[model samples]
Target: MGKHAKPSGKSAHHAPGSVVRARPLPVRSAVRLRRPIDIWHKPALSAVVALAIPDLTLWALGRLDLILYTSAGAMCALYAHGLPYAARARTLPWVVLGMVASLGIALTAASLITSTALLVVCASLVAAVHKVVCEATRIGPPGNIILTFIAASAFFVPQHAGQVPLHLALALGAGVLAWLVCMAPALIRPQGPERIVVARALEAAAGLLRTEAGTGGGEPAGVPHARHATAAAVNAAWHTLFLVPVHTAAKAAARVGLERLLVRAESALGDAIEASAEDAPRDARFAGAGAEADRLGGWARELRSGRPLPEVALSASQAEELAGVAAEEPGPRRPAPGQPRGVRAVLTRLAPGSPLLPIGARVAAGCALAGWASMAVGVGHPYWAVVTAASIYQANTTLSWQRALQRTLGNLLGLLLYTALLPLMHLGPPAMIALALACQLGAEAGITRNYWLGSVCVTPMALLLTEFGSPVPATTLIADRWIDTVVGAAVGLACCVLVTNRRAADRIEVALGRVAAAEAVACRLLAAGPATGADEARDIGWARERLTGCLVELREAVEVAAGEWWQRALPEERIAHAEQRGHRALAGLVRRLSAPALAA
Candidate 1:
């Protein structure tokens, strides 16, 4: 039997002498609340470019008042972040179309309906769709909440049916401009995004090696965390590379070479895992692994700069070994089996059993309740309440709580900033436009660093946007905002508790099952000895890839489940066992590949 197989069928198998430390639930919660920030300036620049072109074009046409509609369309530029240029080109247009579709629905509903209740219902549906689409597509941060916020707010704005078509056309036109701005970066460095992703993966691998080497023996304390980081980087690198089609033979060969380098990086991680298992000496492994990692990083930089590949002193043999492995079993060129492909596939995946459904339900309920509550309490703009509620719903309850706190605090400080700037913004249309632009830039620049800091800018920009139509009393706006913030956040959090995701633990179990199945298949292949045919080799390769993918999914599930407030106790021991056994299986494959060379 495979080491990971359990007779009880509850606990997973663990490698000999491997101990899985069980962290206290409180400690896990506290640790997860604090995530480090990685700032990428490219997206900030992209936002500015996207917003500027349309705003300037409208100003030149003496129709600066239409900038609000253009700004709505410009928000589409925020999608497809971290994607390769080719992928962004395809994704941005889809995002723009989706945005336009949502806006059109909101405008048409607002024009036809006079009752606030019906409008709230319509907005809730839009919020639910936005939530599901964002989660299903993995659009990452500044996600569907923003889209929902804009669309829901549009529902409250009174509009004539005659004006709806022109507004929709404006959004579509601006969306095209946003798409252009996002794709412009590819002109200067076609391969830059993929290179940066691979380089970061190499760096993460180096960090893991260094951490493991410092521990000297047993499973390194930081090995799991470092491994998680390396896995994410490698996965991202693969996705980026896969998105770009290699039309020319030269591009194809170059892509294959880069993929081989990525495989070498993975092998280095496997070596570190094995060394940690066997109590290899710190200095020897560090010296060898560190040199190889640095060499890969340097090569990544060259690739980014479009320079010729440089020869490496330390990794030459390892590179040749990886090449042999590649020849024997090439990595997959497409997404793994069972991944969603088309619109139908995506819809099928988001059915009732999908984990994301509850999240979408929460957004819908929270936004609708908040809007109704605000209206009942006599707040001037109920959409602010809806937007606040939508923004606070995250992947789990714990994150939602944190976001609520951040949003409330940020808005308070933002109110102060808005008070100080109201006088300046009243100067003229140009002044208001420029200040709004600055706030947009600041929000984009700071959002990745801290949500609260981004909120500071977002709050002011939102306030100024209201002024584009007519000037209201500053004091009245401020009072309504304060009341709406408190009401929305309270109602949003209430919904989080009410709509509990009891299936979080079930999802974790399912993920563990996948990890076990994949590991078992790989172990069986290893036991059957070396491959007798290309088909056998390919099967082994696929099994290993599936195992790796399952492990990543398992980690994500465990983290998300740990953060939920009311979910059942997660199978931490079983999870640890599965992880340890999965690593051992991978290490076993690595040893088999290198055995003949070591003996010779």
Candidate 2:
């Protein structure tokens, strides 16, 4: 008996909590339409609704007090970015709490210390602390709010201690409005994009597994397209994960379960690869594998359509038989008679490949430049700094530098353009309100594809936001922007140099090694035949978790490897061949483990 199979008399059904319905992708078109309206529409709507109360309050407060509006608007910007909607829902309270505390501390500190340098130092330190806290606690969106509150409050610190309460109240008011804006989406149908993406990733992984097993090394048709699609799907999944907040204990638990499953699957795949690689195949093995691939392709399509899995269940004895085959060491051989072609195909498709976006020194450099520039310039607001910092991000450092340059140029032009328009538009509450919404939408629309386009909207938004309280000369606004931009671009680039990462290949190698080892172990166990005890399921599950983790790590490492200039220079052809072979082995192992015939 294999080490991991259940005993002969035990029930094969998993424990009640073990199963999780991997949700399929939400029904939505992949391609976007009407770029301007599409991009701006949601954020604009959100801004108009969310900003109304706060703007109105500023207006009611005479709109001539620069302190309130600039401070409040800075807070509003803090509330802007996140997991689009899900994080919006989960982040409000945390943001409010963080903001209030920061406002109070800034007010108190300002009262005690009157030096401008001290104020900047304190604010930057607070920014660093907020970032660290968010990372440490996984507090997410609220962390930004805390940082924003500190920056905004720093601008007015060294005020009488008695005024601290008013500053906090104003921040509280703005935060409340921001929360409302973020939450107003209940009025419309909510699409859970993040949830859908996660589900689709599982499906894609399954499809990949099936395809590798079925093809048996014949030139893969549409191989590049399939690989790209899978890569895109994975990217979408990760992005959504970052944005959304799983608020409920149940949801968090589910995430843990899912993470565990992925980990196991990766470990098992590695073991399978080592075992299979030892055995070379005959022509008949290739032909039979091809037939199975076609069947698994059908299953992949079915999964995409949200079809249920197979209804048949193996008895305890059959499961043991199945487990034994999976644990066998891999070498080229024909499948045991009557093994389902579909099952075999599905297993074959599970190979590793390139990542979606490669990360490297260039990205790190750009990020650091952006972060430092915003800090040093002592800008009109820290939000500008953050946006500039974020805008510099790219798949690599060179790209990051390119984007940073683009943003600086764009901001310079946009600021000048806004200056020209300043004389024509009245600096009244009504005009400011309208301009705010317009710039908010404009910024949101351009942000998706082009940083410069987004900067246009952002520039106007920052400038106009500053004008809410006092009438600053358009010339002054323009000058400040240019100075900040230059600082951000220079500092951001330097950061890229300071944080250079050259270990991408090593990470990829580690992932590959892990996968290979797990597969070998799994195959050896499978070769030993069926288990005698139910407790062996623990070993099986543990192996599966390790295998899954390795697969995920490999995928991530591959994604980041190419972003480094060095990874592209390696013997990619050899690596690619190994991946193909390993994928096939893993799929074959899965097919044997799950086959109904093995139950007999």
Candidate 3:
């Protein structure tokens, strides 16, 4: 064995060749779950605005006869879009479209189907349709199902048969309003604050690099402190990327820049931690850099108060040199640490032949099975289809199954809460509108902290979205929700079991290529000539940063794949070894660039 055993997270355990954790889920310590306030704040603000808008509209229109709840629910969709799931914005329009289609089908079917039992079956079928479309499109969050729930619930609302057209128009009107609200304000470039945050994160990464290079002296206390500061900067950048449209040229460029910074910071941290070698001396150049990091970290905190970033001087040559290092190409490397290969297997099961298929067929099948079953059983509502679709969306199919269970359980309880609240609140338009706003905000606030809590509000919001213009029999509504939830949860889970992916190995290979390319760029910058090559150095730095991001992404993907299926990919140990080796090499590259030759 080599002298270095390889760096491992003290708590992480992995199966051989598998990226998934081989160990059981740990009981985390009572530390508060760390969510960035920045991410939380946007949803909070959006929630408030969403509620406020509907309230105003209801008052202005002077009509409980309107589909204010539809607008309210659609606005809730906007809130979900801002979250950091993969391809978030790309998924929003599909979710909105799903909502529209679900409403259309549910309303059309409701007019023809009279039996309470048949109505429930029809609602479930419609919900299944919504789930299928969303899964096909990789629509936003599982919350996409809520849109279906909203439309179906409206079916049970007691509207005079003749008023159907007016109700449909009102609902469509509300959804259109929501679409405009989402599309319009996104034009405003709130770049100043975001830029400052990104700059701060970059500076912190630079400072950390400098500290680790034998340049600084501080109590070991500073390491943890610096890590904390770096985390804040990273989280802030995540917030910025999550909110804007990534496809736009400017936003895309900024995202690329920010991602590069993130990659650099992650690589630098991994390198610093590894180089310390369990008790290595701190580098001399790191002293000033550590202090600078601390200073930048503090400045970042102040920036939260809307203050501009305080300009601090850097040795222009050193800064330029470091930028160059970041711009270099990625080199050949081994696999990353703690990746899962099982998810890739599960993905393959779904696609069979086409690995890049966007729609998760396995997931859709589960939803369909649940919906079909509920229909056969004559359940009151197809809450089951919604539940089934909502639960199994994790990175791994196994985790998705667990989430589906949790979501179903949570939704079941939430339905009870709605039952109790509906009668007490009296399903009038004003009261319904007020409740919608409150629930939307509450759901948004709780989503980041506790999914269960968010469901509490989400449940009522779903239920009330139906009563926008009419009331439903409370007993039938509540019963159907539970039946649908159970059926959907069961069906969704079953599909996950039946359909799995098989091409995790190929994906991992592709990911490795990206990492190697980025690393090569980084190595080139490290080997560059003097500071006179500043422009070239800057470009190299950006390239290195991009490589780092790609590696992180690949590592995460591999881990997910490994977790879902253990025997499908490269040996878990090999991947981990590769990642550690990569980390060491990258760190070496960073140190070389920061050396006297390059800095001078």
In candidate 2, position 446 carries an lDDT of 66
TM-score of 2: 0.58
* Per-residue accuracy of model 3 over 100-162 as CA lDDT, tens digit each: 666666666667666655655555455545544443334344444566556655555545557
Query: What does the lDDT come to for candidate 3?
Result: 0.52
Best first by lDDT, ranked: 1, 3, 2
Kindly list the per-residue Cα lDDT of model 1 for residues 1-600, writing each as its tens digit: 011111222323433123222222222232222333433467677777778787778767888767667877888877776777777888888888988999999999989999998798788778888988988877776788668877987898779999999999999988998888888878887766676677777777777777776675566558888887776677677667657666665666666667656665566667776777655665555657656656666666676667854433223333444344345323335545555666766786587788888998898899899989999999988888888888888777777877787788778888999999988987887788788888888887767666777888989888887877556799999988888998999999899868987666678888999889889987997899875544554455456567777888888877776666665545667888999999778766555543332310
| Local distance difference test scores for all models | 0.73, 0.48, 0.52
Residue runs of model 1 more than 4 Å from their true location after superposition:
1-39, 278-287, 296-332, 337-345, 530-538, 590-600
Q: Which is better, 2 or 3, measured by TM-score? A: 3
Error of 2 at 413 (Å): 3.9
Candidate 2 residues lying further than 4 Å off, grouped into runs, are: 1-44, 63-92, 95-111, 129-160, 176-195, 198-396, 502-550, 558-600
On the 0 to 100 scale, the lDDT of residue 260 in model 1 is: 59
Off by over 4 Å in 3: 1-37, 51-69, 76-189, 192-274, 277-293, 315-359, 528-531, 565-570, 585-600
Better of 2 and 3 by lDDT: 3
